[model samples]
Target: MSTSRHPLRGDVLGEQPEAMAAFWRLYGLLWSHGTVDQSIKEIARLRNARTTDCAYCRNVRFAGARDDGLTEDRVALIEDGYETSTLTEREKAVIRYVDTFLHDPAGLTDTQRAELLEHFTPGQLVELTAGVALFLGFSKIAVALGPPPGMPTLVVPTPDWAPGEAQP
Candidate 1:
């Protein structure tokens, strides 16, 4: 493990404090009050972490998602061949959606579009799409910033702050 810290680990933020604060503010809203189930989003999040190989993102868990029934077994199944795993169809769809969204949005076929529509409302679709984008961008940033001292398996509260409040 590296002993250095990323500037965006909720403190330095590359010396752009207000921008980072705004980012956290939006992130807090996305997690605390999004329409989709927190567990569903968490699954996609973990999947993104694995895809991006972001150590920090992989290590941090969301308590609300866990409470909503995202168990360790389910978490373990969000890997390379998750389609054959025991995860629900909806869960598998979200992972596929994330993978496509991350790898090639233009490649999303009609069948894939219909699969998403089968399981999610338009609003939920928007949220999930935005969520994947956010997770992907941040995960890439965290990875590009380089290793940030050893991180623990932190279970962050979904409600650690108010819906619109930035992390404290």
Candidate 2:
């Protein structure tokens, strides 16, 4: 279905106003709370969106990232090769943590935690951790329910084959 035609208007917010309110309440705090760099948070957010194949998540513009001092060049490199890109070691560490968290939460090791500690305070770590978990759930919801009607995105993905197709 077109995202606009989604049953729940594509956004859980419209169907479950209370839940969205609670979600945004927490999300608002995570956006600028704690000592973890805003740039790191943006990178983590973008990385989660890309890994989940949620076009809606990917399409939302992150003005915050730019405001946090990330250059367009750095933001552009987030999709594929961020590990080897021009990002600093600290930024790369945040990406690695988010990647591992999304793919395998239990796989996070003390070594990785220690690395994060080198850069983030204990409170910042909590904030970053919560943000990662929130987006993990958020991206899944967006992928399943699709974007809300009239929501803007950079580009929406198209499937190669429809639901029914003749055998090759």
Candidate 3:
């Protein structure tokens, strides 16, 4: 609507081309793999954004959740009372993993790992972990660096890609 890209978006492309290129390559590889559902990935990403308090992540990812078919009600409940909410057991499990992954990764107990293994393969677990790491890393940068000067803090930008659409 504003026709103004987040300053961080342009800064990444302009000041650090190599880093941006690497990020896109990694993002393309994982996002298109289809080893995990787009909905699940969106939820996990939103969870990470919330945990990290990255406005940039939310600005970008909120559109993704919608495209992935998550209803407004569902997104609202993600941080409020997810355990008691209507999200599926699989989603709840992913949320649980993200909690542990963000808070105390080394403290993840055997029971937790076993529970995730019950629903997802070892490979899926790895992919999910990778996704978490990517979001966490990028979120840190976004929240820390923030937008460049003279830019408004919040922007309701469109997602770079559509849900379930694979990109190169």
Leading candidate by TM-score: 1
What pairs collide in candidate 1? 7-13
Q: In each prediction, how many residue pairs overlap at the backbone (N, C-alpha, C within less than 3 A)?
A: 1, 0, 0
TM-score for each model? 0.87, 0.78, 0.77
Q: What is the Å distance of residue 108 in model 3 from its true position?
A: 1.1
Model 2 lDDT on a 0 to 1 scale: 0.72
For 1-168, candidate 3 gives per-residue lDDT tens digits of 355465445465447666666666677667655587767887888899889877767645434446667776777778858999989988999999998899999988888888899989998888999989988988898777663444332423233444554332
Instruction: Give Cα distance to truth, residue 44, candidate 2, Å.
Output: 0.3
Q: What's the ranking of the predictions by TM-score, best on top?
A: 1, 2, 3
Q: Is candidate 1 or candidate 3 better by lDDT?
A: 1
Q: Runs in model 3 with CA error above 4 Å?
A: 1-10, 62-65, 148-168
Candidate RMSDs in Å, in order, are 3.2, 11.4, 6.3
* Residue 21, model 3: Cα distance from true site in angstroms: 0.9
Off by over 4 Å in 2: 1-6, 10-12, 148-168
Per-residue lDDT over 38-156 for candidate 2, one digit per residue giving the tens place of the 0 to 100 score: 67887887889889877777766555666678666777888668777888888888988998998888998998989998988888888999988887788888877655556564422
lDDT of each: 0.84, 0.72, 0.74
Scored against the true structure, residue 99 in model 2 reaches a CA lDDT of 87
